[model samples]
Target: MDMRRTGAIEAVSDGGTVESIATKMGNSIDQNKTLQKTYMLVNLASVHAADESRKIGRKNIASQQNEIKS
Candidate 1:
C-alpha cells in the first residue's frame, strides 16, 4: 500500500510538473510533444510500480506458507 501511495504521489507530481512545463512552452511544438511523451512514461511507470507492489505482497504470503511446510 505504501508503494502504491508513493507511486500515486509521484504520478500526480509529475502531472503537475508537466502542466507547468507546458504552460512555459507556450508555442513550442517540439517541447510540447516531448512533455507529452514524458507524462505518458511517468504515468506508465507509476501504474507498473503499483502492480508490482501488489504482486510482491501476494508473493510474500506465498513465501510465509512455504516456510510452514518446512
Candidate 2:
C-alpha cells in the first residue's frame, strides 16, 4: 500500500508515465480509503456506546439519590 502510490509518484517525478500510474495504484489506494472509512465508523460507534453507557450510569445515580431523599 505504501509502496504503491509513493512509488508511482516517485516514478512519475523521475519521468515515468502518468498513463498507467492510476492503474498501478488504484486498487491499493482504494483499499486504503475503505480501511480509513471503516476505522472511522468503528471509532464513532465506540464513542457512541461509551456515551450511552455514561448516560445510563448518571440516570441510575439520580434515581438512587431521589430514593434516599424520600
The C-alpha stretches of model 1 lying farther than 4 A from their native spots are 1-42
**Candidate 2 local lDDT, residue 69:** 100
**TM-score, model 2 to reference:** 0.39
Backbone clashes counted, model 1: 0
Local accuracy of candidate 2 as per-residue lDDT tens digits, 1-70:
5655456546555665544454565544334656334322334457679989999999999999999999
RMSD of every prediction: 7.7, 12.6
lDDT of predicted model 2: 0.58
lDDT tens digits by residue: candidate 1, 1-70: 3543344346566664544444544534235665455443446667789999999999999999999998
Predictions in order: lDDT = 0.58, 0.58
Candidate 2 — which residues are off by over 4 angstroms?
A: 1-42
Which pairs clash in model 2? none
